[model samples]
Target: MKKIKIEPMELNAVKRVYLLGIGGIGMSAIARYYLHYGVPVAGYDRVSSDITQTLEAAGANIHYTDSVGAIPTAFLNREETLVIYTPAIPANHSELEYFRSNGFVLMKRAQVLGLLSSNYKTLAVAGTHGKTTTSTLLAHLLATSMGCDAFLGGISRNYSSNLILADQGKQLLVVEADEYDRSFLTLHPYLAIVTSVDADHLDIYGTYDAVLNAFQEFVSQIKPGGYLVVKQNIAFKPTVGKGVGVITYGFTPDCHYYPTNISIHDGLYRFTLVTPQGSINNLTLGVPGHYNLENAIAASAAALTLGVPTEKLAHGLESFRGVQRRFDVRYRGTKIIYIDDYAHHPSEIEALVRSVREVFPNRKITGIFQPHLYSRTRDFAGEFAAALDKLDKPIITEIYPARELPIEGVTSETIVKLMSNSNAQVVPKAELINWLKCNNVDILLTIGAGDIDRMISEIVNTLEAKENKAINE
Candidate 1:
């Protein structure tokens, strides 16, 4: 792919910048970006969290309250300050409304990211499931090889940070392209990879076909002469225009890039990677998930296409620790093993459950899942139930209800009722820790996309202490 000159967007020089919803993953990355550049940044979140506190510690003037009056005085200057917000913020948010009423220049997070990426050699990874890990791995490969910068959806266990900024000019920019709100359409990337087009976000998309259409639109925005790496079995056909080459990748033979000679030894997966240039054998991943092998293949293929050698790809893959909350292992012992993952969608949940079953076939798997959104619980209740029913024993928790208002008659009870497993029960999040303390688990797993992650440490401690006491007795 020939690199085209990216005309830089004019950035306003400001003394103080106000972020209306600085707590979002994407918004926080941008906040870090500006703060790293010595820009004075401050913001308000509806609640305080570890992420918000980290931003606060990093010199961002952060407040949990939503009052417009709480905004710093310096950011109130209409002429010099810019207000950035996320689409997740309610339409009637006081701070957002105040910024608009007061003549402040305001922009969505996507628009700002698009403007920033437009000035760089952007490599955008868009998908339903694997965008975070794939983009983070790609960034790791690029940053470790050719100097690069990245904006990631999750904190990299390697960097211990979500935002990876390079001091040098934008030789490469890796971004996790978010499909929510169709934010990825804003990026005109020199390289793009779509891992999956599974039916998701029905609240916004309404149908599977609409979800595919949004992906097609994302492909159209890819710069001409660039490459599009798509997962092999997606329903949509690539309608990329002339000069853009479509490459398919999967476990299948017809894929332009595929994995071969796959094997797992002592929980480590080794595979032979076949690219157009040649094949590399015995490639190992630092992460343990069998599904991650395919993710690594996609990332490595993109890296190889961008001129990274196979050896460097292998080295980077070996060193890649993985993004936080994606099959993150909190505790591992001889008798009791605890794994916590961020798997909200049914497909993701099934994958996590299946992988755990594969790793420990003999042990009885007890999974505790917290449903994420009310819309999703209402939409895919049957699917979620079917997936959770696969485990030996499953416990369903009340829905997290992130952004959407709770729907009438829609709750985790809906999913639990549909499950065939008699063990599946709707448990409150508050009682989870106490329940874990009494329960005897052979292989314990907590899967969710919400605040279930906040309970990981307590769950791990409880399980570990139980195991220790059992061993001593």
Candidate 2:
């Protein structure tokens, strides 16, 4: 069996860090990591976002243009600077070429993160789905009990930042192990958690088996004698590291860790969490939705494995607010209940819609989904349609091409054509606000991973206007 070892970069030698895609969620976190140490930071992003703006305010020199001239003169010294880039950046990018030709040290975002986390005892959460929420909750639990640093995949409502710096001991670091581009392979964590292993990122893995293989390989990197806390019945049975003990958590009673006496009130759930040690009773989840129960279960199991005080469990979980865009409630008006989610996958959409129905029964559900990538739209058009059909009214928006070029026949209408719902239609983002203004909505869900979040404020304002109009009439 081949093993992976990450050699840590000597941070003492590097005077400054330069990032290629500085505005990215993951990239921005790394920039903050550098800034925390008082190291000089500079980067280039394709656009200026709140993330970039925040970085600029924090002593990071950032620009939106891709030109080599945008690079700061001070960072031009090859020996003193380290460059990190996201894989989403195109190969033909001029700035990337300039950095390459000039002999600057370049590493992927994951590689640089590996260098940073290499110093601390790492707790990593990896999966194609369910990782962000689970990791965020895990960070909260540990943060409350014993302070620990975290590099999360989403902006946590509790911390309002993806990077969580421990105020005291930096003994432990929690990281959301990203599977895109096989990036999770960087970490050899003290504890590793696998939340789900569904087929995704086909453009990168090429097949379902490859995705499984990558996950199996990821778990194999767990440190000797550490624990592997995984969801029961997941497809890829991990090949854990030497002396690694496997623990399972799931909805079923057969798992090592599971829930009991599950009950929902209004929208939130209260349940008794069952673990190998003993049962914790009268536990209430801070977030809404039944699907979040699995995520909570997984996080709790990991927390318990790391020796988190059992008494601190319930209070920590009750205070956990959840990650942004992971079933985030934008508006709860008398006329419309709006939720915005970052569910770009078919199975995720199905789960979100199913949970919405569970929470708001008998209410008319309208789902607004933007296809994230043309390749994904081409691959799972039928499945997407089936998931969207679960809603009373489904709106498919124009595809948001994040990193891939548009395919010839794959469009937002592709899913609409395959959908059985008579009310399903295509609405481009340019006219989405107008469509929302004219439409009647009961429980509205704006879903996707791209620029769909940009429309959330406008959609909420439109809903408010409609409510005020009905009152006036």
Candidate 3:
């Protein structure tokens, strides 16, 4: 890979920007940032999604096809237009090829983020999982108090957007440092938080040790005099340069920052945040789940390190509504409760199941999981099965292959057959709602990081209709 240096002042010279996959969450956030800065933006996506429509509504020119002819004439100027593309896009994409051949400066989305980080005091949140929620909450906390700009991985419920703009004088920026493709290495953070360093994206790293080594490299990228806050019990050790501070946060007392005297009341988690500086007592997180409590602690620690006062931090934590699909509760009724999450990894699945069980111990939990990628399912089939088996009933659906082709002999049955639960079975996505109608589902969890979310509204409507019929009867 060629190393190109982009200075902060050079960004002002670019008259327009184009994105190859503009509808993606991270890409859209970057697009929104440029749009806010008065830069003309146009892009192409494989399909028109809600995010694409929102960007279009906000003055971005977007197209659904990959053809070079669809490119806006104004963006064809190679010198004035900067092209940003997601790593997920295929190399053969016509729009990307056109830009490359035409001498337009093409950059990965991570590189753009790195350039932006240089202009502001960046607080980067990175990990295999938990980074999305932790970063979103940390952004909310800092934005609520001191005010900051943010590019989040997920749409924050509190802000109702992934891109949080700062006031005119605000110089702080919060970013979700994605570990995939080793993208987080590009960032030089003033404050960095690693929530977990679990082995994931093996297709990219090819080994668990490589993942750890990448994280170690990420930790090394923290700027001098910056702070590094990590979750307790994560395997990777920090190799920060001099003047960098390291702190750990989790549920246990050994962590520098932890929660004490935890309790759940009315579906909310209340705890005391015990940090090295001081303790914030009776802090109540607006979101549910045990894993979320840990996330809140990590976010709080990062915020506190940045000089957010204890009172503002506590209020921000309580006011946070959480990110969409992290632990989104679609419906809660006496007959049935339905929740949806974007948990594709086995460790994330295990956390979801354990949190759900902790919240509703007596409820008969039924889980419908669609594996996200062929590579992930093929790699962690047994782990996925074991995680889903924690539920009372497990329903595995066909894999949602985001980029990779289907692996031979690896299907939903691969997980179903390995599940220890006798009630486990493989079901097609089309039949899921119908199956839900016939089954006795006390607590329903729809889990995955793919098109499984497309089925949520239908499932909710069916469940509501069923509940109405029972009420009338």
Candidate 4:
């Protein structure tokens, strides 16, 4: 654990902090952090869930409605409070407008995080899929070695919380740099890791090239004398100045940091970490999934640059329980196994299916997937269909419209039509539970980045019951 000293920004004895979209994993971590600092926190979310209840129980005032009047009186005092919001929020949000018109010091969540990181020894992890897991691993590595305060994108299974180690003494800060809306650009980090530069957020970037350009812009923000670690085979070449050092890490030998002689024993991956200094052998990951191997390599590269000992790095990764919803194994039995993964992009889905095939070489894999956004489905219909077609039996659900309104010609049918596999079917969300009841499942996987999470518990329970009945018989 290493602590970097930051000059404290003086506040005018502000008694309250208000967060819009406070229920989001990243937003909630900030909320919890503010609460830990003894600031009275209050927030508004579009819906109520387990997270909001937890925050409310932990002493923050929360309401589900969007009514501007629902805001607490203390938070409404402009001179003594700060309002923070997420870009996922609709532009026309009433509370946002109220804060704006009233002259309150409103800031984007990324801006606030950037402001926090500017004064600390920050380690920001950026990518399309593995950011959360890599950031969590890096945070755990630093926290165990020295200490770090982290604001992560997913709840770490090890900590059961999205935030970890809030002490100011351990100058290290770990942040998940979200690529959506070009949010990662705000962070100026001491050590930064780019895990993947896949073309995601097409609606925002307009094209794959634009997305790559945004990532390049982000790389330029690395502080002078800082370290930048990038995954191998990424399309773009970064142009950097004198002080910053660049390192490449991946599964291939050309990378400065790569894995050597990888093997899976008893269902756990063991690989030698080949770094610039030397190779560290027999490194094991607590979480399953070969995609995570590359992520671990990337995290290890950055953490080593931050001065974590190779032995400590091995221990931290081995002890990591993984982030929730990233290849999360819910139930396992000899006859039936159920897994859920938050893989929405085509590349992610391909890697996920590949991992499953590798792990269970001879099993029948039945995959159910819910597409995340209408824009994404419309933009990558063929790619999505191709990825889903890889499975033995693929079930499709209606698009989960997170922020965008439904596009005219974009629907589940668009994707189903593109699939060459006849096993694919467009299924309604309501009928899925019953549908699965009658169907046979060997290795079941539910994949997506949307409300598919709402069904995880039910799906797990149903599969568990089937397993129990077979055992009893």
Candidate 5:
């Protein structure tokens, strides 16, 4: 395939922009960006979601149907309109086909991001996991002190938006470098952070070694004199170019940047950040979970590297409110507590379960998990089962096939059967909410990366109603 490079200045000529999957987290950020630039924006999504509605309210035209006729006529101009589509959108999508057939300039979402990043000093966060939280926190840190533009994967609660525009005269850019579809390779970052190199997206890489190779390639793309901050004990050794620097950070003391003297007070984590420059003592995180502490360490390291003052870093970490759906606490009461998270991978589930157990040790934790992808479920069923077995009671729902067709013999039962927890059972998606209503849930956790999030409002409402009824009784 031939690559077509479009400079950032060329975007100024575009009067309108159309997106195929505009409601996606990444694609929506780009939509918001175009809208911010005063361009007329419109897009098609498979469903009308809160995100899509938000976009509509912000003046971008959106439609739920996928027909070509549904596209607004204003976006049909071939020379004046640019079409951006997510990779998840099917190749045969009617609107996508119309744009391609009509000679409109079409680009992938990653390509558009690459063009935008090239116009500034891009700081990219890439990994199999933790990239969203790390990148969002890093954006918060930089935005608070020096002002930066950010393209985040998850919506930051602090800012209430995923796209953060830079203040005038600030050339800094922070982006979440997605590993899926080898999208991160499009970015040539001035600074990069590799949080972890876990084997994932096997459908894309085919083997674990290929995944490592891709990360190594990503490291090599850093511009000369750039810095690469990586997590301690990552398997891939980066081949950094001359004048490029490497730094490691983790919870251990050996890391150049780490934390020590950890303690929790008033349900929050307080620890001293130990860095090569100096140690910041008695710092507290605004979010919960020990894994989040590690994410904070990585974000702080990146900020410090960029010459953000220690005081600003401390304030940013303490004031950060965390991202939505990462570890969102929906409800808390004496009778029942409900939490929701976007953790579909086995390792992520393990960390979430462990953190919940640490926070509420005496309570019975009931986990309701919906597996995300067929490939991922088939690839990591045993690992998923093992992690879910840690919960006091586990409810497994059918797989949510995001981009892939259903695989024979690969279902939620695959993991349910492998789990050692005798309380584990396979529940259909239709019956999951009703099943929860009938049960006595002490600590409720809804964990997955798919449509499971759509059910959170109902779960919270039901649980809240239950708590209110009990109180009145």
Candidate 6:
């Protein structure tokens, strides 16, 4: 919230861009955006991962250390360099301190996003669980039917990147509106979708009601005469400004936009998407998941509002591959199936398990879940236990602490102790693949929001080797 020497509207005045936490998903997308516009980009992160590697490949100067010397020399000139940072960066971070002392132009990632929305017709999707999938789907739908530039929170398997650049004509911007730390408040979208609002980030908001109130404020920020597309069954009912249009979508026909004649072939869905404009028959979602049917409806409504033809929407949906790590099926072996998902909250876990059960009926599901934060683990241990208990075999891993210090006695066992399912047990992330080697798994899921993703490739390889050895014997 510090006063910026150069506002995002004055981005052209800035000579270079530097990010504090360049490896983060949202931050990396912005870094890519600046790079695409021919700006010199540099940054610092605590660690390097696939995201940072990709950014480096795309002409970003990134370093893992926090030293001020780690910054590129070109970005050293405070007057010419704009520094963007994420909320995850700590107050004591040395590079952040150096930027503060040097009097550089500063902005939060969301602030720049708000500035972008001011220039284009913005379509934003906000929620606790389904925002990534919904927003990515909307971006794909718009990009294929018409054209759009998108800042996504997840890597799109179709685009293979989180940032999508719009072609010259009919530019629209699609963004995933994050609710954590009230970040989504910065956006005033022409079309906003709320997929779900659940009790999350208790570390920040402290109460479920606070989470609802923040979302309520978010919807109220939608531009007048714009559209509010929300789920019919979510707990919160939004209050929008005068002349703002409201549309509801869900599984049943009572909603404004719903699907009918749902059928599945080879794990993919074919259904009639019923919207107020008209129905798109035989629309096939490129991904498999019962939960995604609702996402499709929300995205489809937004796409239709923006003048996308029904035929183009249908074609786009059929070709749309989902975001990576959101019900991403890595491999399908004859005896073993491996999937990965970013389901950190209890509600997300429940939906994921339900969809997995429906998709691979009669297959035993063995899920490895790494809880994300200490506060969340402390606040929702029982709920998590109940949700994870739904898996035939639930393997709980060590908690991944992103920002907060650990609370005494709050560990992965915090959830396992509350579980009624005897099969549930705690394991360290380092030992997960070894555990997999010994255990029998029919359907395997690696689920979480943390570095648990780093273990995914090894897990898939282990499962594949196990299957091959079985056949050789």
Residue pairs that clash (backbone atoms under 3 angstroms), model 2: none
Model 1 residue 256 lDDT score: 86
- Residues 156-251, candidate 6: write the lDDT tens digits: 999999999863477588999999989999999988999998899988998999999999999999888899999997888799999999999998
Residue lDDT tens for model 4, 1-473: 22221223235445678999999988999898888777899999988877888899999999989998899888889877888899888989999999999898888888888887876788899988789999998888888887888999998898888999754475788999999999899888877888888888999999999999998888888889988998888878886655999999987789999988888876678989888899999999887788888888888898888788888998998998898888888888768888888999999999999988887889888999999999999988999999999999999999999999999989999999999999999888888889888899999999998878778889988888877888899
If scored against the real structure, what TM-score would every candidate get? Answer: 0.96, 0.97, 0.96, 0.96, 0.97, 0.97
* Model 4: pairs clashing at backbone N, Cα or C within 3 Å: 1-145, 1-146, 1-147, 3-170, 3-171, 4-171
Clashes of 5: 0
Q: Comparing 1 and 4 by lDDT, which wins?
A: 4
lDDT of every model, 2 decimals: 0.85, 0.89, 0.89, 0.87, 0.90, 0.89
What is the overall TM-score of model 1 with all chains considered together? 0.96
Q: Candidate 1's residue-wise lDDT over 74-140, tens digit each?
A: 8888777778889878989888888888787788888888877876888999999988899999999
Better of 1 and 2 by lDDT: 2
Residue 284's lDDT within candidate 2 is 90
Model 4 score (lDDT): 0.87
Clashes of each: 0, 0, 0, 6, 0, 0
